[model samples]
Target chain A: MTLFIQQLFDGLALGGVYCLAAIGLTLIFGVLRIPNLAHGTLYMLGAYVTYFFLVTVGVPYVAAIGLAAVVLAVIGVLLERIVFHPLRNAPHTHHMIAAVGAMFFFQAVAQAIWGADFRRMESPISGSVTILGAQISWQRIVIVVTAVIVLGLLTWFIKRSIHGQTIEAIEQDRTGSSLVGISPSRVSMLTFGLAAALATVAAGLVAPINLLAPTMGDALSLKVFAIIILGGLGSLPGAIVGGFTLALAEVMTSTYVSAAAGEGIAFVVIVLVLAIRPTGLFARAVQR
Target chain B: MLTVRGLSAGYDAVDVLHAVDITARAGELTVVLGANGSGKTTMFRTISGIVRPSAGSIDFDGRQLPDLSADSIVKAGLAHCPEGRHLFAKMPVEKNLMLGGYVRRRNRGRVRELLEHVYELFPILHDKRHQPAGTLSGGQQQMAAIGRSLMSDPSLLILDEPSMGLAPLVTAQVLDAVAQINRDGIGVLLAEQNAQTALRIGHHGFVLAEGRVVLSGTASELLDHPDVREAYLGV
Candidate 1:
C-alpha cells in the first residue's frame, strides 16, 4: 500500500510538468490558432537558457528560472513578429510550414550554441523526505507545489483578470472582439509570447529530472501533444485532467505491467479514447 | 457622425459592395433596409474596417476611417454590434458585458457606470449576468449584444440585424431598446431587412439591393414609396 502511495505521488508530480507543458502548447494553439510544431523547441530552449545562466552568469537556481522565462518570451515575440505574423493570412498550411522551419532553425541554433552532447545540471535541492514508507526528493515536491501555485494563478487570471478575459473573448469570436476595441494582432503576439514563456517554466521544473539534448524536444513534444488531445484541445481544465490521467496510466503500467508498456501507454490510451470519444475526455460542446 | 462615398469592398475578386454613399448623423437612427444576400452587411463591415475598401473613403468623426482598424475605430467611438449576437458562448453574461467596456478598462468607475446603464436598459441582462451568454434565449441574447455595444460608451452604435432569428414580439422589444438608445443621443446605424418595423422607428432610411443603395428618404417618405412598399414592406 505504501509503495502504491509513493508511485501515485511520483506520478502526480510528473503530471504537473505535463500539465504546464500542455497549457503552454495549447494556449498558443487556442489563441494563435496555430499547430505550432516548434513548441517543443521553445521548451528545450528554456532548459538551455537556465543552463546558460547557471553556468555562465551564476545566478541562483530560482533566479535562473525567471531570467529564462523573460528571455524565452522575447524570443517567442520576435519569432511571431518576424515569421508567423506575415503568414497568418496566407493559408493554414503556410503557418504550419513556418512552424516546422522555426523548429529546425531553433534546434540548429541550440546545437551550435550548446553542442549536441547531453549534459546534466545538479539540482540545488538536496536530500529527500519520506511520505508513508517511501522517500521523495525535495526537488520533486517543489516542482509539484510550485506548479500548483502557477496553475492557480493562471486559473485566476483567466477567470478574473481583465487582460486574460480579453484573451478569452478574442479566442471565442475574433470579429466581435475586434469590433469591441481589442486588437487581434496584439492579442496574438501576447498569447504566443506568454505560451512560449510558459514552456520555460515546464522545462525549468522537469528538464533537470531527465536527460537534455536538442533532439529531446522531438520526443517529448509528441507526448505533450498527446496530453492536450487527451484532455480535449483548447480546454484548460482538460489539460489538467489529461496530464494526470496520462501520468497515472504510465506509472500504473510500469508498476503492475511492464516498463515497455508504460512508455507506450499514452499512445494506446489516445487511440482508445479517440475511437470512442472523438472530441476527448473533457471536451464537451462548450469548453472554457 | 459617419459618411461613406464611392465605397467598394469585398472578399478577394468578389466585390460585395459598390460605390455606396451613406451618412449617419448624431442622435438619429438611420436604417439600411435590404433583403437577404443584399450588400447591407458588407457595407457595414467596410465602414467598420473589417473589410478594407477597394476605393473611395469613409469619414467618421471628422477623420478618414478606411485606414483605421476595427479596434481603432471602436476606440474612436464607433461600436459595431455584429450580426448573429456573437457573444462568447462560454463566458458569463456579466463578462460579456464587461468585455463590451474593454476599451475603457483604464476608467474603472466609468465602466461600472456603463454596466449599470446597460442593466437599466435591459434588466433581464442584469438578472442573467452570471450565466454563460450562450444559454440565454434569443431575445435575451440580442439585448445582451446591444447592451455590450453600449458598454463602450460609443457615440455611434452600428447594429446589424438584431431582428434576425427572433419572434415578432421579441423583435419589437429589441428594436424598442434601439430606439431608446438613439433617443439617449447616440448615433445609430441599423441594418435590417424588416422595412416596416425599421422604418417606423427610424428618422431616415436607405434601401440597398445588389450592393448599391437603390433608394433613400426620410422614414415617412420611405414608408410611402411604392417601390419600397412593393419590394420590402410586403404591403
Candidate 2:
C-alpha cells in the first residue's frame, strides 16, 4: 500500500508536467482553432532558455524559470503577429502545414543554438522528504504544488475574470464574439502567447528530471495530443484530468508490466475511451 | 446615425449583396425585411464590420468605417446582436453579458445598472444569471443576446433575426423588449424575415430582395404596399 501511494505521487509529479503542456495545447486549440504543432518546439526552447540563463547568465533557478516564461511569451506573441494572424481566415490545411513548418523551423533553430545533444539541468531542489514511509523528492513536491496552484489560478481566471470569459466566448463562437465586441484576433494572440508561456513553465519545471534535446519535445507533443484527444479538445479541466489519468496509467503499467509496453498504454486507453465516448471525456454536446 | 452606400460583399466566389444602400437615423427603428438568402444578415454583417465591403463605404456616426475591426466598430457605439443567440455556451449568463461590455472604458457601473434594466426587460434571464447560457431556453437565450449587445451601451444597436425560432408569444415578448430598448433613446437596425411583426414596430422599413433594397418607405406605407403584401407580409 505504501508502494502504491509512492507510485501515485510519482505519477502525479509526471502528470503535473503533462497537465501544463496539455493545458497550453488545449487553450490554443480552444481560442485559435489551430492545433499548434510547434507547441512542443516552444517547450524544448523553454528548457534551452532556462539552461542558458542558469549556466551562462548565472541566474538563480527560480529567476531562470521566470525569465524562460517571459521570453517564450514574447516569442509566442511575435509568432502570433507574424505567422498566425495573417493565416486567420486561411484553410485548416494551410494552418496545419504552417504549424508543422514552424515546428521544423524551431527544431532547427534549437539544434543550431543548443546543439543536437541531450542536456539535463541540475535540480534546484535536491532534497527529499519522507511521505507515508516513502522518500519523496522536494522537486516532485514542488512540481505537484506548482501544477495545482497554476491550474487553480487558471481555472479561477477563466471562470471569474473578464478577459478570460471573453476568450471563452470567442472559443465557443468567433463570429458571435465579434458581434459582442470581443476581438477574436486579439484574443487569439493572447491565447497563443499564454500557451507558449505555459509550455515554457512546464519545461522549466521538468528539465531537471528529463533530458533536454531539440527533438525531445516531439514525443512530449504527441503525449499532449493524446491527452487533448482523451480530454475533449478545448476543455481546460479535461486536459488536467486526462493528463493525470494517462500519467498514472503509464506509471502503473511500467511498474507492473514490461517497461516497453508502458509507452503504448496511453494509446490503448485512448482507443478504448474513444470507442465509448468519441467526443472525449469532457466534450460538450454542441458541436462548434 | 448609420449609412451605407454602394456596399457589396460575398463569400468566396458567390456574391450576396450588390451595391446595397441603407441608412438608419437616430431615434428611429429601421427594419430590413427579406427572405432567407436575401442578404439581410449579410447587410448587418457589413454594417457591423464582420463582413468587409468589397466596394463603397459605410459611415457610422459620421466616421467612415471601412477598415476598422469589429470591436473598434462596437467601441464606436455600434452594437450587433447576431442572428443566432451565440451566447458563450459554457459560460455563466452574467459572464456572457459582461463580455458584451469588453470595449467600454468607463461604463462598468453603467453596465451593472443596465444589467438590472435588462433583467427587468427579460425577467427570465435574471433568474438564470448564474446558469450556463447553453442551459437557457431558446427565448431566454435571445433575450440574453439582446441584453449582451445593450451592455456595450451603443447609440446604434443592430439585431439580426431577433425573432428567429420562437413561438409567436415569445416573438412578441422579444419584439416588445426590442421596442422598449429603442424607446430608451438608442437607434435600432433590425433584420428579420417575419415581416408583419417587424413592420408593425419599425419607424422606417426597407424590403431587400436579392441584395438590393427593392422598396423603402415609412413602416405603414411599406405595410400597405400591394407588392409587399404579396411577397413578404403574406396577407
Note the Cα lDDT for every prediction shown. 0.87, 0.87
Per-prediction DockQ, in order? 0.84, 0.80
RMSD of 2: 1.8
Worst 10 residues of 2 chain B by lDDT: B99-108
Residue B17 lDDT in model 2?
A: 95
lDDT for A110 in candidate 1 is: 94
Model 1 chain A poorest ten-residue lDDT run:
A279-288
Task: Please write out the lDDT profile of model 1 over residues B127-228, one tens digit for every residue.
Answer: 999999999999999999999999999999999999899999999999999999999899999998778888998999888889888999899999999999
Q: Report the C-alpha displacement of residue A191, candidate 2, in angstroms.
A: 1.1
**Residue by residue across A9-42, what tens digits does model 1's lDDT show?**
8798888888888887777777877778898999
Top-scoring candidate (DockQ): 1
Residue pairs that clash (backbone atoms under 3 angstroms), model 2: none
Q: How close is candidate 2 to the true structure, as a TM-score?
A: 0.96
The fnat scores of all predictions, in order, read 0.84, 0.88
Q: Candidate 1, chain A: TM-score?
A: 0.96
